[model samples]
Target: MTRHTLSVKSLRTTMADRRAARRSRQSLERQLASYTSESDRIELDAILSRHSGAEANELRSIINRQAMDRLIRTGA
Candidate 1:
């Protein structure tokens, strides 16, 4: 390919990758918005820090369940 064509293709690929990343971040933000409590949000951040591979939805569900379990155990 010509140098000009190669540059154009490279720019297009970079832009597409950036757009995909932005969309992924927006989706994650929406999922995280489900956790309205401060403690749950803090727990989520801790969980995310420790479990880097976990998705927001899955981790949120786990944190919510764990919080519920704690509440039940304490009878509060």
Candidate 2:
């Protein structure tokens, strides 16, 4: 492939990745909002805003685990 074609392909992949990430983040935020109190949601949003990349991923993982635990306990 030509250099220009390669660059275009890379850009398209990057854009798609970003869109997927955004959707995932929004879904996680909605899950948190549904499960957390208003104060806790606010605090969580603040923490998310302060972190990005791997730190953010770790936070999301922790939140997901807690959410799963709650669901299991409630049989939901």
Candidate 3:
């Protein structure tokens, strides 16, 4: 393929990846909202805003685990 064609393909892939990540983040935020208090959600958002890269991923993983635990405990 030509260089221009390759660049366009890479750009498209990057955009798709970003959109998918945004959807996943929104889904997780919605899940947290369903069970968390407003104050707690605000705090969580603050923490997220301060972190990036692996730290953010770890926080999200922890949040997802805790959410799952709550669901299981509540029989929901």
Q: Of models 1 and 2, which has the larger lDDT?
A: 2
| Inter-residue clash pairs, candidate 3 | none
lDDT of 3 by residue, 1-76 (tens): 9999999999999999999998987787667646565578578868798888986886677676777777899998
Q: CA RMSD for every model?
A: 10.0, 9.2, 9.2
Indicate the TM-score of model 2.
0.50
Worst 10 residues of 3 by lDDT: 29-38
Error of 3 at 43 (Å): 15
Off by more than 4 A, model 2 = 38-76
lDDT (10s digit) by residue, model 2, range 13-38: 99999999989977866666465654
The candidate that wins on lDDT is: 3
What are the lDDT figures for the candidates, one per model?
0.74, 0.77, 0.78
Which pairs of residues collide in model 2? Answer: none
TM-score of 1: 0.58
